[model samples]
Target: MDKAMQKVNERLTPEGKMDVLSKWEVHTLLTASKERFSYEFRACSLAVLNTGSTEDNAKAVLEQYPDFKIEVIQQERGIKLQVSNAPAQAFVDGEMITGIKEHLFSVLRDIVFVGNEIETNPRFDLEKTEDITNAIFHILRNAKALQTEVLPNIAVCWGGHSINRIEYEYTKEVGYQLGLRYLNVCTGCGPGAMKGPMKGANIAHAKQRITDGRYIGITEPGIIAAESPNPIVNELIILPDIEKRLEAFVRMGHGVIVFPGGPGTAEEILYLLGILLHPKNKEVPFPMILTGPKSSEDYFKQIHHFIESTLGFEAQQKYKIIIDDPALVAREMRSMIEDVSDYRRSTSDAYYYNWILHIDKEFQLPFIPSHENMSQLELHKDQETHLLAANLRRAFSGIVAGNVKEEGILSIEENGKFQISGDEEIMTPLDKLLSAFVEQKRMKLPGSEYIPCYEIVKPRNLS
Candidate 1:
């Protein structure tokens, strides 16, 4: 270890959100050295320590601080963190940065809570759809994410963490428009498109004197290391996985605005479309807008073409695409939110959570994204649109895992590349869409060459 790397032992109190831990939980956390929690805690802690860093490579970040270690220390009053060879960026003049300290404990709080209460507790039946939603609600409630007093103003922004300057600026402009209308922001809690909205919203909120603006970030364990929660996120909630994280965004926000992004953004769009396509959810009003700068017009065109070719007209109708018009995008979203408000009010649904939306069990279940699982997905168009969307969602989920996730990366290294075989009609457009993403440099950050983590194979036709 370097001389500057110092071992710091201190007892810290939880900041705004988390405060106390049960004795059993404290003991479990304190003794989480050889288990998954230790690995998760260390990776998440390192990511928090590496806040404000521009680099997005998780492996590189880990390599930089190979010796940095964090351990849980149990105490009579909750617990404390014992950090060894800790990053100096997280500390100043012998004291840890207050925000970073709070984030560290927040990680501990969520991990323990999820592992013990949600996963192990028989009360939350993970197999059932309602049970899964309940589990998500409990996790968010534990994080104090949902507010009863707040109106329907949270705009969930979805886009690539690795975006160009033009796209990033465009996201900011849209965010500024949203902020001008007193709307708050939520994102995947990463950089690039995610950070851009919050950054722009912050300035606009200040100008409008909106002091209580919420910049919420929702993330899961697998991708947190690669895309560390951006510094602008005042409220952070860690879902158990990507599926729950996506669900949380839709349930909590009144509207969604998608900017130019890669497979992950595509997955989000499909997920939302799948829900909207369900017969029960068709009447439930939820606003979705896809917008970008003029430069990104081609990107949206490709995405639109892909959706039309795959999910058909119904999926395409769920969202409106606006090019280079931030004000109009915000105005449209605001107007649609009013409809959402009126509909929810008439239906007696809670303003904080959209209880009316019907999310199918297929979408709720956690996808393992293994080689066998990826190959076995039902990608034919003969089924219901919503069911097809669920399968398509899983396909993208696998691709997402193969791209940046540690397990997926290792799988690719060992097993070559994941192969996706489906109907020729679907495979053709899917290949073209994925090819466009690769061509436009949306698959990974600029300057990093992307070796495809998936192969799209066409199905055999017996004519």
Candidate 2:
């Protein structure tokens, strides 16, 4: 069958900060060497061109546009992106949408910078925890995401793209409230919960005559295909991986409000908990609130139970769960923002970034979702609670990979389901928690049956 064809060529300059690229950076981006770096960049660029597409499956999207290609052209002034067989929605009267064009090139800028400067730069030293944090800071700085003089107002919202109508409306309500308080919104930068907040905040921002409100989106390559940057995102930054993306959220946002979500959201919560549970971070004043509509009360119940059972009361105590009240959620976030402001003043930390939180190396390193890696994860209480949170974070990360990421899906197709073995005390609750997510259509978009991507195995003696 002949594929749908929509071709357009356009030249776009930086809208926000990416106005020019260095000569070497432009050269590296243009040269397609068929290396892993180039391949990854190509994949991510394809995903960016596929913005506004309704299809959620990355494999399906790639298959549809198998011949789609992008190339960077160096000009006397700067760089231009050439494309072929791109999506029609990204064009109007055969011209690329200005925002989409900026986003497309932003992908190029970030992919090239991360590939050449951060990943290959030996100075990054990904093995060391501080080095990794520095790398994250530098990437965000390069993207001009960090404002040295800004206040602590960015609120990171976490939830799933597959959420139902009621839950999505709840997210919008919470976002509207946050906007009324002049708090900017940050999200994984996709649809559903992510988009709802921005949408609501846009209205509130307009109402409050706040023209400079920021809707920042932090995403990674692996998940961007499934969750394209929503149209509302004024600033989009692509982290190298999910781990860095989560780290970026915590480091940048003043407060967090988690809505109903799936394994991905669970992974984010665990990542934050792991960091906050650290002894050095015991006094850190980060405010985390998990809230949803009345219908989602049961969802949080299961999540609360799982956290209590696996990570114990201390982990559970680290976050507050507010249900059925968007006003209260926003009010609490506002109050906490003041508290955050006071704490940062006392500690003399930057308002734009959290400099005092101590993130361990275990949480910074990328967790490859291979079967061996998943099976070898330490999920017992033999270590520190924060460390166990890191391992559990990895477990959910594997589940997220299996469900959506292209490579993880391909791995599962070839080797069957990922095997997750751990102490029964942990595995039992995990199984229950994941099972609830599956039943509630939280794992994937509704109307699609979700096959178990992982097998939960309980240790004999612990059971």
Candidate 3:
């Protein structure tokens, strides 16, 4: 079979996890793969099957394999996937790669479970913040992400998938140091920074003869096609939405290390900052460090300036900044994590999840990145700093959607750039920071020119 034109057909059985499903679960999955929910399920399945892709364009990937089809067939023994026209790259000697097969079943498991148990069930009142948090907890618990007896050793790394070589290498160095200390890694589970950390940690774990090091990758539907799970992700999870994905990262990880990135990274930074700055979370011992290689010194400077100018110095004090030193970054985070563990033990909070953290409804509710919402964002200093951070985070989230998500890309193509207007005080610094990202070529995958999907404007009242 020609690698380009020849498509392989196969029946894949779950080899690792999620092998068994109830009759109802299997029926729901079968329905989801049909016409009603076909697009969502197919898109996610395609992403899982097309792992190792370097291209970040979701639309292009789908178009490239227009004939690809996946069906959930109920068998006498169990459920099996009937996949036709899948990417030839996913196969080795005509057999689907073992890891990709596992991921495909995991996607089926999550989509069916979430659709039936969370979306359609009346018990989960997503309107209530606590209920929403409970739903997230249940999802993670169902995935077996929360291990109560385990110490707090997971470090969530956030950065741009379109990072430079230097920045990517720095992320690996930090991950190596973290692994040397027996810390596991959790990332958004895509390329560049996300892949680098896991790659580095795997080697460190091997060196230490640690067989069970976890490389957890948490993502969502909207962004999954573009940022498909990197092969290094041993534990893959698909959250219902980006908001839940962000929450899962904070809840599941012991600490966070942010590297130089674009708007997505900025959005993650703001999300955590908003949560940490909440009055109720004042005493929480969450460790957050922003670090990068020497070339990224100015990068962190711009980020620091932006945060300070917008959220004030109090938010600035919430996280530490270390430049050009990966070893120290890991050591400092490890030490701070000790404090986190002690706090959790003292407060009777589980080491696996940060149950005591107060996440307001504002942070929990999903923010639709529509043009009107972007235009009406309250990016002024009138509200509490945390509230302001939430809005700012939404602003960046819109940019992220416009940059990579398929819906946002189509919206931009049809409606033109999203209009984002706010107080000049905020807009000025925000614009500067965004401009720096584009100028640094951090907006899109390397060699692909970035077209601005959002136009920053002055507030109407001020104008």
lDDT of 3 by residue, 1-463 (tens): 5565457889988776657777877777777668455787888888888787777888877888899999888887668889999998888899998888878877876776565578777889998988888888988888888987888999999999999998898899899999999999999999999999999999999999999999999999888987899998989988888899999999889899999889999999999999999999999989999999999999999999999999999999999999999899999999999999999999999998898999988988899998888888898888999999999999999999999888889888988899998788899999999999999999998999889999987654555
Full-model lDDT, candidate 3: 0.89
Model 2 pairs in collision: none
Residue-level lDDT of model 2, residues 272-369, one tens digit each, is 99998999999898899999998899999999999999888999988999999988999999999899999999999999878788988899889999
Candidate 1 lDDT tens digits, 298-375: 999999998999899988999999999999998998888888888888998988888789999988989999999999
Candidates ranked, most accurate by lDDT first: 3, 2, 1
Give the higher-lDDT candidate: 2 or 3: 3
Question: Which of 1 and 2 is the better model by lDDT?
Answer: 2
- The candidate 1 region of ten consecutive residues with least summed lDDT is 2-11
What lDDT does the true structure give each of the candidates?
0.85, 0.86, 0.89
For model 3, give the RMSD to the true fold. 1.4
Q: In model 1, where do residues sit more than 4 Å from their true spots?
A: 1-11, 21-25, 31-36
- lDDT for model 2 comes to 0.86
- Identify the superior model by TM-score, candidate 1 or candidate 2: 2
